[model samples]
Target chain A: AQSVTQPDARVTVSEGASLQLRCKYSYSGTPYLFWYVQYPRQGLQLLLKYYSGDPVVQGVNGFEAEFSKSNSSFHLRKASVHWSDSAVYFCVLSAQGTGSKLSFGKGAKLTVSP
Target chain B: GPKVLQIPSHQIIDMGQMVTLNCDPVSNHLYFYWYKQILGQQMEFLVNFYNGKVMEKSKLFKDQFSVERPDGSYFTLKIQPTALEDSAVYFCASSPWDWGDTQYFGPGTRLLVL
Candidate 1:
């Protein structure tokens, strides 16, 4: 069974500061990785995705994630976050031959303090 | 950008009752999925359906649970004889195709079974 681990439960960063959310997955083979963000009282939105190709993938709102096969990780990074970036970010994994069912991590709540 | 809409933002029912959650997936999407998320917990996959058939289901999808897309109108998850443990947010998602495709999620229906 593939599972995602997001060690950070909550993070508080000042506006305009750089941010990184660490994500690690337990899977023998490479799987589809994704980052989704959910604002209060809203549906989840895709931030970015990584499958095969270059390790780095760009997403909406200055968000990006790098797939590290050797590290078994795909960490989301933002050069500079705005107040609007405050939300619950989820790290998701979708393994092959599993009907594309997503396995989500306990989302990390990010607070961009002014 | 695509959107998946879920009917009934919130639902409250007594144990042993029946509840149906409706999801209007993206028009061109072919795969529909249901996920359960408890308060402060990670989202867990419940089931996935395509071609009017269930492709996969997790253990959380108990025997009391069922899914169907009648006439290709709305994808529905029906829980008969709901238990207190069923109190959680149910999210509906859809993807144009399976494997590596972005899944658009609905706002989720908060179900509370007393």
Candidate 2:
């Protein structure tokens, strides 16, 4: 079965500092990766996605993720984060032949202190 | 951007009772999905429905859980004889025909079973 691991349960960063959230997946075949962010009292929003093509994929609000097939990892990165960026980040994985269902990681709670 | 809307932001019910959560998926979306998220935990896939039938379901989708969308109405997930373990937030998502594309998520319905 395909699964995701976020590793970090919580990460605190000072405002205007860079951030990198690590994600690792266990899948036999090629995997489609996604990064989603959820704000307080709101629905989850797509930050970015990586299926094929260039390793680096850009997303909304200055968010981006790089897909590494060799490492089986797709980590999200932001050069600088603001207080508004504080939220829960989730790494998701999807593969062929599973009805396009997505498996999500345990999620990382990001807190940006001002 | 498309939006998915879930009704009854929060629901409280006793164990052994039935509860129905409604989700209004994005217009023209063909795939509908349900995900469950326990408090402070990651969101997990429960089921995915398309063309009035279930395409896939995870092991977490117990026999007590069922999903349907009648007459092009809201996609509904009914949990009969709910348990304390079923107390969690249920989120609905939808995507266009492109199975590998992004799925828009709803705000989620918080269910508490006592």
How does each model score on TM-score? 0.98, 0.97
Tell me each candidate's RMSD, in Å, in order: 0.7, 1.0
lDDT of 2 by residue, A1-114 (tens): 999999998999999999999999999998888999999888999999988899999999999999988999999999999999999999999887776789999999999999
Error of 1 at B46 (Å): 0.4
Q: What is the TM-score of chain A alone in each candidate?
A: 0.98, 0.98
The residue-level lDDT of candidate 1 at B51 comes to 97
Candidate 2: list runs displaced more than 4 Å: none
Tell me how far candidate 1 lies from the true structure as C-alpha RMSD in angstroms: 0.7
Error of 1 at B29 (Å): 0.6
Model 1: chain B TM-score relative to the native chain B: 0.98
- Give candidate 1's iRMS in Å, 1 decimal: 0.7
**What is candidate 1's CAPRI-style docking category based on DockQ?**
high
How well does model 1 score by local distance difference test? 0.95
lDDT of 2 by residue, B53-104 (tens): 9998989999999999999999999999899999999999999964578999
What proportion of the real contacts between chains A and B does each prediction keep? 0.85, 0.70
